[model samples]
Target: MADIESEQAAAAAGSGALVLFSGGQDSSTCLAWALERFGTVETLGFDYGQRHRVELECRDALRQGLTDLNAGWAARLGPDHTVNLAALGEISNTALTRDVAIAMSEGGLPNTFVPGRNLIFLTFAATLAYRRGLKHIVAGMCETDYSGYPDCRDDTIKALQVALNLGMDRRFVLHTPLMWIDKAETWALTARLGGEPLVALIREQSHSCYLGDRSHHHEWGFGCGTCPACQLRAEGYRRFVAAAV
Candidate 1:
């Protein structure tokens, strides 16, 4: 088993990686993480008709910003692809896909939880990776300090990895660097990866608010500050800053 795992890792390292970048802090950090490790790195985004579709707009700038931060990153960064998963929005009636209120559902999960979102996302990403001859799929899905999205759990990702490999007959490795880290650690990670310039780029450009608001700018970033995404990011930034002080 160890040897097989080593073989898989070796194969993945050679074939480059595809990062599921959402123009959010976590995904941006994950992109940098992939660039640091992989020889070739590409990005993929989904147009799921999300409320914060504005995030899609930030993707290009974020990619270019990362390139400008490091010459090596610019050389390794490859083409980006965006898929139109608008049907997801048409089928899901939730806060993320619709204009509904952001609250906990009676079932306990947040309304922002889009059913089978990560599952579908990974499946699509694996399909693209296969087409692009990329054996590694990197995502920013996190269980720690998240909004209780079941799909973001490590178990879900691992299970999906197996399913994707079997379904595609390809050994595609799913990399989730943020699976076990909180938002504070996530901020620190960007700092470690690209220093203050990358941190400032993420703070100024990345969009995490569910309401799609970019008018308000806080020390952490731009958001309404009341939404779960903004609150988590803001509190995490506070903790990260306090720890450094």
Candidate 2:
């Protein structure tokens, strides 16, 4: 398999894109989608000193898969561009950071919610794109199923786009392929872009669990299957698989 950098490099040929990849199902799917669409894709993964290093491991695996998918593409994609932006770490109190109890709060931000994560990530991605002279940055943020997150909202992304363009003195396109799609639709999209084998690889290899539990059933990826993310993923998978049959 191609490494993240390699796969992205394959995608990054003449028409390039920068993707905010997290080695999770949604982001992996987006990565694959970027490869198919842009031909030249660059990946940016952040290391905020999360307690779980498995995310990075999976990221590496995804990158490798990308490389294996198209070695020539990987070669063209260029090196993996990753950053250890732990500055955003201190601002987040989510379970993704500290050892505090992980629970989904009611009617407000969930404990799994990291403060300004997407904003920070997209900002970094945009900055990198600006430096590389690429104007397109892709993320997998969803509004249909995850409308609770303020950052994932379409208004928020559009605002951020405006801010980034103004701040950088350049225009950039923020691509959110999954923004309007629910999980089931997202799965269908992945299957369409990457094939059934790739979608299966995503379902089995990607990590979506906030708890970092790797023993969950096959329905969801790694992590406790009872969490909101896992439940939603499982539901989406069920819907997709049933529909396919």
Best by lDDT: 1
Q: Report the lDDT tens digits of candidate 2 across residue range 3-45.
A: 9877765544456789888888889988887777675678888
Cα lDDT computed for each candidate against the true fold? 0.93, 0.80
Q: Candidate 1: where is the Cα deviation over 4 Å?
A: 1-13
Candidate 1: the clashing residue pairs are: none
Model 1 TM-score (2 dp): 0.95
Find the number of clashing residue pairs for candidate 1: 0
Best by TM-score: 1
Which parts of model 2 are misplaced by more than 4 Å? Answer: 1-13, 70-76, 104-107
Task: Give lDDT tens digits, candidate 1, residues 126-240.
Answer: 9999999998899999999898889999999999999999999999989999999999999999999999999999999899999999999899999999999999999999999
